[model samples]
Target: MTSFPDPVVLRRGSADPQAPLVVLLHGRGADEASIIGLVDHLPTGPSYVAVRAPIAEGGGYAWFANRGIGRPVAASLAETMAWFETWLDGEYAGRRSVVLVGFSGGAAFAGGLLLAHPGRYAGAAVLHGTLPFDAGVPVTPGRLAGVPVFVAQGDADTVIPRELLDATWAYLTTDAGSLTTTWRDAGGHGVSSGALAALGKWVGER
Candidate 1:
């Protein structure tokens, strides 16, 4: 088994141990601090934890090694997933609910987790990133049945390849059988106020 770095977690919201947990993952070349700010735009009931990715990259952090944008190496992804699960199971084994919110590269990581474990998480929000393809996760039809997923994509995004993005949108909406909420913005690779508003509402609903 591959060893991983110790996780760095930043917390916000309620201190109650029983509070529902929301894990926020940042894009590549970013840290926990980058996604922690998103807490201000989301609902207040859950305890939000921004988790820094374990792999160091360009002075920041990455969840896994990748050949290109949205193309994660299978071995690297599996190793990191194991490392994350070790910490996650230890911290939230009996928690009532745990949700994931990820952006860009982090979104792909979030998708990998959801696909790998199926019902492990209550819900997930994928913003501006594609799901992991051919990365050792089952992508069969209805793999995510009953999972509540929110996907927001920028129509003008150039960082990630368009084909990958479209394929992710199709799988999440059609094949995954998830209760999905989708949004398409005319902007670039970042979140917008409208998307955040929709996300806040969706988070509250789930």
Candidate 2:
């Protein structure tokens, strides 16, 4: 059985309770330690929090069932979303702004969190990921209405087809209109230095 602690807390960055919170979610098979390295690569102004998924995969962990080549399971997705909602409200009670950073499955979870809550996040950075298209999954217009989102995808991502990437881009950009999509010329399903550089710049500017 997969179990996440009550608080589900993991810290990086300087200890500053008043600092803006930036949550980083890692990809499949990678733990919190994987992407927490981005802390040194991000703007030093925010307090960084890297969270590991609750479920323990054979090699690493996963937010929920991948749901094959279609979409995530509605119930599982809802559970994950609710968990994040409760965590966000509880932990960031009166914080000024919250930034979300996710890669691969982490990106999916981060995107879902913003989609489910909308307008709550100050800004978001989605790396090598896409938004899921499901009937029950929330994608309210006002959710990400004016929120700045930085999306980076590799042109040759074998894991996620170009068609899926384009569809996700269209949905997010058209609906949110505040999304900035960057396409890298790299291959495979991983983050790139260029994407990291762009994310760093976007974090500083946002």
Candidate 2 wrong stretches, greater than 4 Å: 1-4, 140-143, 179-183
Candidate 2 Cα deviation (angstroms), residue 79: 0.3
The whole-model C-alpha lDDT of candidate 1 against the native structure comes to: 0.93
CA lDDT of each prediction against the hidden true structure: 0.93, 0.75
Model 2 C-alpha lDDT per residue in residues 1-206, reported as the tens digit of each score: 23455545578775677887888988877788888898887888788888877667868877767676425666776776677667778877887778889888788777777777667888777777777667256665545777788888877787765676777777667867665656565656887777888888887776
Among the numbered candidates, top lDDT falls to 1
Where in model 1 is the C-alpha error above 4 Å? none
TM-score of structure candidate 1: 0.98
Q: What TM-score, over all chains together, does every model reach?
A: 0.98, 0.88
Each candidate structure's count of clashing pairs: 0, 1
